[model samples]
Target chain A: MGSPAPERIVRFSGTVRLAHWLLASTFFVMLFTGMCLYLPALSRLVGRPTAKAWHLWSAIALLVGIAVLLLIGNRRSLTGVVRDADRLDQDDVAWLKGGPRRLFDHDDAPPQGRLNAGQKLNTMVMLGLMVVLAISGTLLWLGERDTTYRFGGSVLTHDLASLAIGFLVMGHLYLALVHPTTRHALRGMVVGDVDRAWAERNHATWAMSESVQSAERNA
Target chain B: MTANAPTPRPGGRPIGRAAFLGTVATGVGSIALLSRYSGSVQAAIQKVSAAVPGVNQIAPTAGWRIYTVADQMPTFNAATFKLKVSGHVANPVTLSWSEVDALATETQVTDFHCVTGWSVDKVHWEGFRARTLIDLVRPAGNARYVTFVSTEAPYVDQLTLAQFTAPGVMVAKKQDGVALKQEHGAPLRLVVPAMYGYKSVKWVGEIRFDAKRADGYWEQNGYDVDAFIGRSNGLTGS
Candidate 1:
């Protein structure tokens, strides 16, 4: 035919995109309600009980959503990302060590795959934050009647975790929306596909070997 | 107009503009001070209020978070303060400060529990029991519920007669042997020790004996009317 018809490559499957958005929405809901609970002035605006209830419910939704995502999500996509994020190659290490220049210049970067070293680190930290937040949040809720949880410093842990996640989310938003080089990658999350050319340029290591990884669940 | 000009109240001191502004500023500043610096700062502010004319502004008091509808808390003249009991009561009476104070009073040490997961332990609250007031008012046979209306408008709560007369319940005027600061619902606030903090209506100006329970401000805003410390509000764990 004309030119071997431009091969369509999918960056992320629909299942992966659904999971990402679900986590993001729940996170934002918790953040909004958490801020209302944290600040007294804000609490007065949106009654404390409302804020407390929303915070609790959203926290529950986040857990349940994660569980459901694990249960029904594409097994290959779920394990593939976690496996890729956990094991960093020499190129990922070198790309991370490239410092601030890595933001604008990917030339010095060792051939990156689906996710870079920075993203891997962010994923790990975010997971850790979720674990602590859930534990501390449960304790604080229980402390309502039994002060034992309060005595164990659940409030402090919850507050610190809140502060950390607040900042981490802001950084994540900046990269996803504002960072010149990384902003282009947001489409991969939004529509679940990206140009193979862009993938080749950004994630050369994965793009070259990506043909074996089909977009559909054929594997 | 003049600094010494007398207010309408018989024994009330005329609060000059400067003093009023100063009080308002202190209250606003105190409210701005976050609860993160709670224990020491709150104690110090309470000490100041104990010695000075209580700032009729909001402030975190002894770990108690203040909630009110008015933009600024209105100060009450204890010398001229009055509690009016009417509605479905057989005896409608407006008791002046002295009359209300003369009723039999008790000081009980109890922990104050807020639904928001904070508790202040062993607070000494001195006040006459709600039963004491109910006895004096003699609510009519038809009156099943009582509404505690706050001086702060749009902020009110309700309690059944039985709930109002519950043991450990009282109309608290003092906390820890000290007259209540404005932010703590000065002059008078209902103390429902068994329930969450919202049930305790602060700055109570009038007590209306009603035939039915009308949800208070918090209740209207989706808060449980019962407001038990652990049992209500969709909470399961004790």
Candidate 2:
């Protein structure tokens, strides 16, 4: 018999995948709503009627997505813990110095599990940013929440948060557009699959660990 | 997972053509119903009515929200606060707060709008009208714009001579029945109900009439310059 295709690599469960896309879609909506309010140039294009409606509605949608993610993915899995992901060991240091090219093509890089340390780090950063954005955005929206619960900070603080978010978005765009292996991450989200070769090479530890667990369960 | 699979991704839908058509039809129907049900006439009036721009002040009538920033008390010291009124004038003069305040007291009640959709109505503000200063300084005939410079460096706003002299425009020293709160704008602030809140420059220290117009901070950062208070008014400089 002809050799069968290798078994598909399932990186995320159905609930996890659903939450990811929901959150991702909500992020774009929230971004557009905030831009409409912040940038008069955009406000003019949307006009007040559409812009105000879009801001309020999209914000509500963003909240819903975040709530869904929190409900589904809030557990403290080993993956959720900060330590394993945040370490910028020698390989990461080297990759940073050489620039992103070495990290892509799965060339001359250290073995990583289901998610590489960098991917984990990115996830952590994204989570933290979303939390901050949600809280600060709420304060800005609701107007003058109790000073005791103040997230308005100073005008400078608000401006700095905006700049930081802008930088994070730029970094996200760079990784998605510039890096090949991480570029595959986008397709994974869209198609809900990653090639076995891609997964084994980039996330060998994770793929191997998952397979071993499956074998144990079957045996 | 393999790149190709017959199974749909999470949250993916079949989205048949019939369903798509149904969605479009529903959306159009809802819009039509909303247009018919909602007060389009009021919206039309809000657009084309000849009523004065600040006629409907929300702050006075509605209990809108206000956030207070910590006060930088006594922002202007007669010893330190010197207003340098220069540019396109025969003689440049720097007046102290006491000197400026001693000029004719001009109070105006006008609406204030932030680009972020918050509007305060009929805020009673008191200040020396720029018109009074314009009269005193006798800006050169070509001086067609006024630039407001604040102690908070790098924030600036420019106004055309016509808008600069608009009725109820003031270099406000007070707001809402009190000496202007520091967070609101203390020492001196510009209050123009007809424009967006950023146009109401806070902590204003200097007013310069310019022969040439200059871009304000918000304008450079992609906000409208002549931010008119009508619905559907696009955010672009005339």
Candidate 3:
């Protein structure tokens, strides 16, 4: 049909928004704190004492916060099933080819209600990164023991993971700050509200879902 | 240009510039607070000291059996191995596989703490006490620091002689009740439970003693050197 008015689009619920922001804030803290612990230049910026304390506490908080968010949020909506496994859906491929411009040209883009393909992909990648980091990190944290579980792979694996995670974080940061359409995405996290057009253009699938529709009707 | 590289702050200044004044203020405030509340500082020191790695938590049960070097097969051959210690030191000693293994033998049951924040109780590790090696070379009287260079490409750690010699610093060769698996330090590794896992440099290849301090791989990249558990070296302000 027609594009939903900016005021009409139902963005993430208050609880969902809260959970998202909590996780995001903790993630930022963990990133900075981790950097301080891993890289000397950042550590010098904060000074070792502060870096050490912030890194440890932030990590602990991030771990606990993410756990709570994982349980509280709707996991299914976050990770949609691939209806056709062996094939790349034409819709997704078209969106991928369109890149950033399509996201802004509302009419040309798919009717994404609450989350778009790009956002969905980011969410999944981030979730996987968190799990891998948490697991490997816990192993390294334990130090060398008689345990059977190995945390870091070879030194090369560990190095590569570090680089990968660093880049992932940079990507996450870029999405938040660089992309115009997604730039407002950060505001939704902070204030727990998104303009209707944002919800419609970015997360149509989520916005159109029964849960969201039902909530909007009830509201 | 990264998608998320930090952007300029609201005041038209860089994030670094914005953080500069605040960082200095925080630093001074912290120094004041630390001096005023010496107890906290002492507590921080104690907390870090205990976090050191190589404290074996899995106590040796009736079934546990310690193995000698001769009893086990060589997990890694010395032919291709090399230990290169470089950075802020008068003598950068690069030891061959044979040389590293030959240092006076010291063994201990110690724990390992990874930066991710986990601890393994106790495992037997065999190697030379880093201090003994330093004593032999007598790092110039000015050399007050030591850094462990890991064969692990791109990761290294600098340790103060005090931290290295605090106690139970063994270049690990054995773990649990058997020879160390290749996955572990294998041929040679450092086990200093007094610090975290990063401090226990694995696949160690070099030891550089110096009068000045330098950050290890993680420290240089984004980790704490003190790496004491429970207490943050204050890398994160809050």
Pairs with steric clashes in candidate 2: A9-B1, A113-A205, A113-A206, A114-A206, A194-B1, B58-B121, B59-B121, B113-B197
Which residue segments of model 1 deviate by more than 4 Å? Answer: A1-8, A212-219, B1-238
- What DockQ values do the models have? 0.01, 0.03, 0.04
Which regions in candidate 2 have their CA more than 4 angstroms from the true location? A1-6, A48-53, A69-106, A144-156, B1-238
Candidate achieving higher lDDT, 1 or 3: 1
Give the alpha carbon lDDT tens digit for every residue of B1-238 in model 2. Answer: 2111111111212222223344334433433343233234223334443364653331111223332122122255656778889999987899987788788986777767554443444678888887689778889999999999877666689889899788878888877878876545577888877776778787787889898877787667555578665431233332
Docking outcome class, model 3 = incorrect
DockQ measured for candidate 2: 0.03
Query: Lowest summed-lDDT stretch of 10 residues in model 2 chain B?
Result: B3-12
DockQ: which is higher, 1 or 3?
Answer: 3
lDDT of each: 0.70, 0.58, 0.53
What's the candidate order when arranged by decreasing DockQ?
3, 2, 1
lDDT of 3 by residue, B1-238 (tens): 1101111111211222223334334333433443234334434444554675432221111111111111122246669777665554555577787876677786778756554323445667776776667665656777778876665555567778787777787777667657666546566777877676767766666777778788766565455668774443332332
Q: Which 10 consecutive residues of model 1 chain A have the lowest summed lDDT?
A: A147-156
Q: What is the DockQ of candidate 3?
A: 0.04
